[model samples]
Target: MYELHTDRLTLRGWRDSDLEPWAAMNADPEVRKHLGDLLTREQTDASVARFQAEFEQRGYGWWAVEVRATGEFIGFAGLDRVDDGMPFSGVEIGWRLARTAWGKGYATEAALAVLAYGFDTLELSEILAVTTSTNMRSQAVMRRIGMTRDPADDFEDPEAPEGPLRPNVLFRRACGARV
Candidate 1:
């Protein structure tokens, strides 16, 4: 099993036990604010299945993040393939946590570890991050992790509906860059 350890968290592969909390986090409006809408349990399960498949096939994907000290399943943080049609196609780093896990710097901490894994371990030359223009919270996390925004890279998310979510901002960080 691929696992990554940070100062306060562990990023590991998905488990059957993570389904309940994962569903609840997906259902939380606050948590879904930037992710479009709340996902049904079925949708959440399908997503978990997909994440597992990606891990099995590619050896890495969105990892199920947990607090090291408490073993609490806080949420997920890792890398995913940017869909084929996206403007800036490449691997993207992302995270999603329960509302309780917010504001504690867990996202930044876990993201730093994931970034290191992607660059240092996986040897990826670059990683990107995307969020809706209004998602200042995630943008803050992106900035905290040393990702920089390139205005020309920003594009409307084709997958998002014709609304606030469509206008997404892009952030990028190259391997070996200071963070």
Candidate 2:
């Protein structure tokens, strides 16, 4: 039920209308490039179900992002618990947008809002972000939100198939650190 608002975007709960566009976004090879294989519609729907459940249980999770003016479902952005087998444990920040939404600063705006909520509302001491080494776009957003990376923190992602996505980078932003 948690939601966020920005000048041009709304970070809100998932809706029935979001499924189609969400599936399409997941199917985008460019969007899923750093991420592994493209997701099928069933996989996409299952993921959304999980996201919704997580939000209900924790009061925060991947938010369905929409353009406030046009009401277009662009993608999702929010906080989630780091998966169990990752080298590190803590909340992680992430976002995924349709190609149409790229280069428009939506990720940065939504991410900044997520960080503020994590620090001010949830009172967390830190937040983390992980991405493939080649995911410069996400890395830029991480840096813009004041997350700092230590090369020592990088790891091989167990989830990624043996490929470019395996060598992952970890970035951290302590509470109160802001860009």
Candidate 3:
């Protein structure tokens, strides 16, 4: 298993045991607020399978995030190719955590590690992060990890429902740039 570690967390591959809590995290309304609809167990399990396949095919994908001390599966954080049909295309960094994992600096820590791996290990020229205009939490994480945004880069997400989540913003951090 490929694993990336931080002082307090571990980013690694999926496991059969992750299904239950992963499903519960996706089912949380607050967690789904910026993410859209709650995902069914089947939907989440399929996502896990898809994520695993991404690792097999691409050597990198969303890694299952967990606490180092307690071995708690809190969420996921990793680098991924931009989804097809987006306004721009490049590798992107993302993180999602259970409610219990919120407000603890875990997202920031995991994201910093992801950015380092994307830029240093993978040698990507730049990394981006996209989120709904309303997702201040994720946006804040982007800023904390030294990604920058130009309001001019904001765009409408054609794939999002015709609502709040439809409007998206793009944040970028180029190689050799400092915050």
Candidate 4:
């Protein structure tokens, strides 16, 4: 298991024990608000199964974020490629945490670590983070990690309907930045 330990969080792959909590978080309205759609239990199972498969195939994927001290799963943060047609490709950092897990710096903290892994371990030249324009909270985190916007690189996300969230912001940060 490739597990990353931060001061307050643990980034790791999924486990059988994580199913129930993962389902609850996916079903949480607040957590799914910005995620485009809320996943039903069956969908959540399929999602987790896909995540597991991706990890086995690619050696990495979205990692489950847990508070090491309390052993509580907050959400997930890691690198994923946009499956929808887009202009660029490679690892892109992302996060989805329960509402209760927000307001803390966990997203920023975990993302920075993933950025480091992308540039160092994965040897990626650049990593992108995309979020709907209206998702100011996520945009702030992208900026917090020192990623700059590339307007010319913006592309329509096939998964997103036309709206504020549809106008995706592409934040790019190269290697050499602090993780």
Clashing residue pair totals per candidate (backbone < 3 A)? 0, 0, 0, 0
lDDT of each: 0.93, 0.94, 0.94, 0.83
lDDT (tens digit, per residue) of candidate 4 on 1-179: 48888899999988777778889999888777667777888998888888878877887788888998998888888888766477677678899888888889999999888888888888888898988767889989999998989788776676777765576778889888653
Candidate 1 — worst ten consecutive residues by lDDT sum?
81-90
Model 2 per-residue lDDT tens digits across residues 1-179: 97899999999999999999999999999999999889999999999999999999998899999999999999999999999999999999999999999999999999999999999999999999999999999999999889999999999999888889899999999997758
Q: Which residue pairs show collisions in model 4?
A: none
Evaluate residue 131 in candidate 3 and report its C-alpha lDDT on the 0 to 100 scale. Answer: 96
> Which pairs clash in model 3?
none
Angstrom error at residue 144, model 3: 0.4
lDDT of 1 by residue, 148-174 (tens): 998888899889999989999999999
Stretches of candidate 1 exceeding 4 Å from the true structure? none
Highest lDDT: give the candidate number. 2
Q: What TM value does model 1 have?
A: 0.97
lDDT by residue for model 3 over 81-173, one digit each (tens)? 998999999999999999999999999999988888888888999999999999999999999999999999999998898989999999999
The C-alpha TM-scores of every prediction are: 0.97, 0.98, 0.98, 0.93
Question: Lowest summed lDDT over 10 consecutive residues: which window, candidate 4?
Answer: 82-91
